[model samples]
Target chain A: MHWKEDSAEEGDLLRNALAGCEKAWADLFRMHYHRVYAFAFRSGLSAEDAEDAAQEVFVKAARYLETFKGDSAFKNWLYGIAHHAVMDLLRKRGRREVLLERLHENDTTSKCSAAAKHTEVGDVLGQLPDDLRMAVVLIYYEGKTHKEASKIMDCAETTVSWRIYIAKKRLRKLLEKRG
Target chain B: MKDDPIEKYLVKLEVPTPQQEAVERALHRSTLAFKNRVEPKITQRENTVFKWFEKYYLAVAFAIVFAAFASFFPWAERVCPAASETSDLLAIYSEVKMLFQNNLVAVLLQGSELKVQLGVPRNVAGARVMFVEFSRGDEKIKVLCLEGSALRVPLQGKVQPVLEAMPTADGGVILMGDSFVWSRAMPQTINGYNISARLL
Candidate 1:
């Protein structure tokens, strides 16, 4: 479901959670956990790393709850935090080079199994630069609009469009070379 | 418009789903963290105070150093011998510092008219005092004034001589310095022996 449709319910859950309601906290966590996990994964983290990133995002959100000004949707604010958390995880692991090497290796191998295809796609995404990767992940994989993705990425909406343009061009070249 | 080939390809590609047990584990850990959340209002207040300190620490340090230097070797003492009466001069300097601290200097400087008065206390013989009053809009402030004779004292300290004292036609003197001017005149007595004094 779109975040807008559930925004009022989510806001109530967030308010209750902040008010120390355990059930509300559980409900809020269950609501966004998968999406945040998927965001982390699509942002070039491994499954385990994504889980760690998601956990860190929620912890940080709780810790800095007062900083949430309600200027933006809660989901976008959460995604902004998620963006930083995922980037920090990736930087800490120094996984870009490894992912690139895996991408090159997978390009030469047969695209047979579903698991292999999944890893190949992730590796291909990881091969893109961090900014371009984020643009693609937020706009394409996560189905965020340019405006919403700009909020998540903390950049101008035009910058988001430009980054997506560059990312798609790069991805096209990479895929064509692989074929 | 038809979907781009790349978009079609990416959309069709199945991303791996997170394992159910892993999601449960993350939820458990996150909920525990959420339950034990720190009080954000306290954290935000502390952060604001720290930010304020970070921004003004240098200015605050300089103000401290200036205050210490001014107290030890006051500007009044360097300009005039009568100002060597450090106790009285320092008291006036302390008053000036209070005015500065309370952001009253601007108001005093920009006051509409300058009124000067001189009086001697009934009990204190040979001790003359001057009152300088300033009015800004409806606000009135009166500051203790020092004599031009005080500024005529020979320079004795390493401090640069900056004060200019101009005597007025009516036996009043105007003492001009870097940022302020103080005007004073001879004592004015109301009754033959009863000279009322107003101390700030």
Candidate 2:
């Protein structure tokens, strides 16, 4: 499902959630769970780990709802939380190299065309460092501008631009080698 | 940008959607966790006290350290030596006057003791040092009441006189001779001045 940026609706849901409305919290969780999951997955987490990371993001958002002063879009704020949650899970599990190996093995073995392509993409992303991979995923897969990607990744715009440039160069080299 | 092959692959990458049942389960868990969360209720008075400590914690810590050092170490009292020494001198004078009025001379002059005299006060390291003399024939026992400062006892004669110094509670010292029998009237000195004694 395509999730549009609706600040007014999100603000109302957030206010009701803060006012102890459980249904409002559930609504907010359902609305953003898919995008958070997809973000985690495209950021080099396994499907199961992405699900866990998404759940963690919503729980944290609910916990720190008051700190959101509506300075930026709630989507950006939620993506910020998602970014940290995914990175923390990655760091704690120490499975980046292992996941890369697994993705390469799946890319070579998978017979289905769509699954092969998806695994190939994951394998290529897994080759980039965590920061550069996040830059590529946020810009290309998530369709965020450099400004929004910088905010989500907690870096300067120039840094994001630099990372994307380096990441694209390396990805082209990697894809050419595969071809 | 639109014709870029790498961007095209990344944009077309398909991420597996989480099952609807898993989403519902996660929502229920998050809702339960949110409802179970208890924010601490801070009263206005408690908040004010917290903010007060936050603001003046450095000054309060400094005062506590100063007070602790002053109580533990005698030399820290040198910071205000004049006031302490003066009060100690007054206490010693009042005790000596009471001893003289009671005709305690006979008890003090048990053997060859003739008389006792309070000498003039002298300044030593910003503290007043008073001398009490107990005379017996040609021999005299001198007691030095040194207060507020850690100054060495002043000895006028070449003789060492066998000095003994006892520390009082308020950072003062009582120095006396070994030959004399010191009948300690008050064992514990209050405000650093309890030197009421008769020499035998």
Candidate 3:
């Protein structure tokens, strides 16, 4: 199933998965794994932690599938689950110090290639406030609109736009600082 | 888009993809967990008296209303006496909860240890009424309006009632009086007030 967000709004795939359809479950996993993994990574979890969180999130979603009630987009509901998983991991790891250190490491990973500038630019991305960083990741990286990002983040669309605007301003300042 | 500096960095930002084997393993385990949690609930619901009541409570309520309309029996003057006779406020509350689940506006409170949901029903005795469910662990207590009547819900243990709900502008009263823990049925009203006042 192509599972477009628009089509998936009726939640047939979710209903099928809840009824123990293994194929439906696998298709949902394939469709969501990359986005969930990306969100986890951008939320400052390590590769290993992100993978674990993704799996944990899917399992929790499956367990609670019946309670979904279809009040929002399935993708938005999935993102809410991912947010809780990331928050749990962050709480376990202790928040600011670990997050800043992991973000700093993103800047140093590639030294002698074209990738280095991109990695350095990511330093500003990493330094943005958590909510702003999430807005940038969902909109700029994941190709979601501000409205979709707002639903996933459980905030108003205006809040999403303001976060994106603030992130852009802060990123500009960081670039100047690096220059 | 390629010239946008922020876009360039985001495009290059490395996100690790889950390997096929790892994803398959997780999916298999999740399927098992889903079956374990959901299947039992389905089966248990099949056998539960509560489920029976939930499935047929509406039918029973309608039948009672019809019987009341056709009777000269003074008992018919009391609507839903069968439900009241049981003196089980919790049971009646559950049936009402199911009847109004879709119309309830869930109020979410922050930083509260207890899971509290408060909402008003769409219709009750030609008036809108509010209810709250307080849940901790496997036990949940629901304080709901009873149209024209009120029943006293008993407190459990040493817990004293602390919070009182004020009447809204819409003629709907919230549960009021000194806060009493509504853990179980009392089978007796502490007063002669309608069920709405007792719930409030």
Candidate 4:
């Protein structure tokens, strides 16, 4: 019942936002910023980069509001924008390779103790391929349903399920070595 | 998926969150950008009579209704006007109960005449009302109004329903439907009805 009410309120907010109500748009930004920032951070961006990416996502969403029909959850649409912005940032900086190389160089330091390994989950996540890492970040840390994740990730729903399955197997192996 | 240690650890991963200051900064920037984009339209609206109505239609409409009822019925003023946030037509409907009938009148847009079946249920009523149709792709909805009552077109293809029926003080009945819109543009033709109305 609460879910229904929230959905109705969200629908109204979307309508108002699309109709150019700045207050509604700002409310939407505040409500979803954390998740978009978390997705960017978990994808291995620095704090500054993630914040920038999240802000860009919201601005772009406002610019493209007319294109968003009431076809899916607003967050799904938003995450789609965040995904592209973060990926673009990563591509422009060549940041993925740099982060992966840094992860490898830190492997010796992580191998020193179980305590060290436990502290290295955030670093090790950078070593996962981007697709799998994003799947993991969105589903696990960000707590999106598989279907919603699929829409944001621009893939089939079953593919999201498979990515999550594969990501878990990989994360389990990495975390076990750390422990 | 559930109770997996790996999942637990992943959930525990420390991720960066935007600080409150950062959030406020971003919101201000976005809102400013949106305002800039929309400023011209707002400027244009400021000079329009319709903009005047859009802003003050409620207070003025309520004042008119209140004055009409204030003479004999002291309780009329105390009756809360429906908050004007919804639509102007709705405000009128709430004050005048007789206008709530779901009577279907086949509106021939060209004639500006509402065809009325005198004794039939939901077939007719009286008054000049505006009908507006909005469409996105193939989806369409018609907002119908009469006197002060209005209703949305049914998606199930049924004729519009009568919203309310009440006898007026003059020994006659006023039939109305509970639906209305703030604007209307005639479509070339309603799907199942025909008229010489200019529709685009």
Give the candidate number with the greatest DockQ.
1
Q: Give one digit per residue, the lDDT tens place, for model 2 in B1-200.
A: 87999888786567876767767777877887788755545556798889889899999999999888788886865678757655664565446656664222111221353244333323345433444444434444444343322222233444434333444455434544544323243344222223343211
> Which candidate has the top score in lDDT?
2
lDDT of 4 by residue, A1-179 (tens): 11122367676777777678888887777678887887887786666677788888877777767666556767778889988898888777666655654355356433223433433677777667778888888887778888888888899999989987887788777767877
TM-score of each: 0.58, 0.57, 0.50, 0.49
What lDDT does each candidate get?
A: 0.65, 0.68, 0.62, 0.61
- Which 10 consecutive residues of model 4 chain A have the lowest summed lDDT? A110-119
Name the runs in model 4 displaced over 4 angstroms: A1-6, A95-119, B36-200
**Among all windows of ten consecutive residues in candidate 4 chain B, which has the lowest summed lDDT?**
B191-200
lDDT of 3 by residue, A118-163 (tens): 3454456667767787788888877788888888888999999999
lDDT at residue A122 of model 1 (Cα atoms): 73
Worst 10 residues of 2 chain B by lDDT: B102-111
Candidate 3: CAPRI quality band: incorrect
Which digits, one per residue and each the tens of the lDDT, describe model 3 over residues B1-200?
A: 67977566567766545566667776777776666544335545466787888899999999999887869787767777645633564454455457556443322222333122334433444433335444444444555443422323343444444334434455544444464322223222223222223332
- Candidates by DockQ, descending order: 1, 2, 3, 4
Superposition error at A92 for model 1 (Å): 1.4
Clashing pairs in 2: none
Choose 1 or 2, whichever is better by DockQ: 1
On TM-score, who's better, 1 or 2?
1
Q: Write model 1 residue lDDT over A1-179, tens digit each, in one string.
A: 22343468887887777678878877877888888988887788766677788888887877676567777777788899999998888888887654764455355644324657667677677778888899988988788899999999888999999999998899899889889
Candidate structures ordered by TM-score, highest first: 1, 2, 3, 4
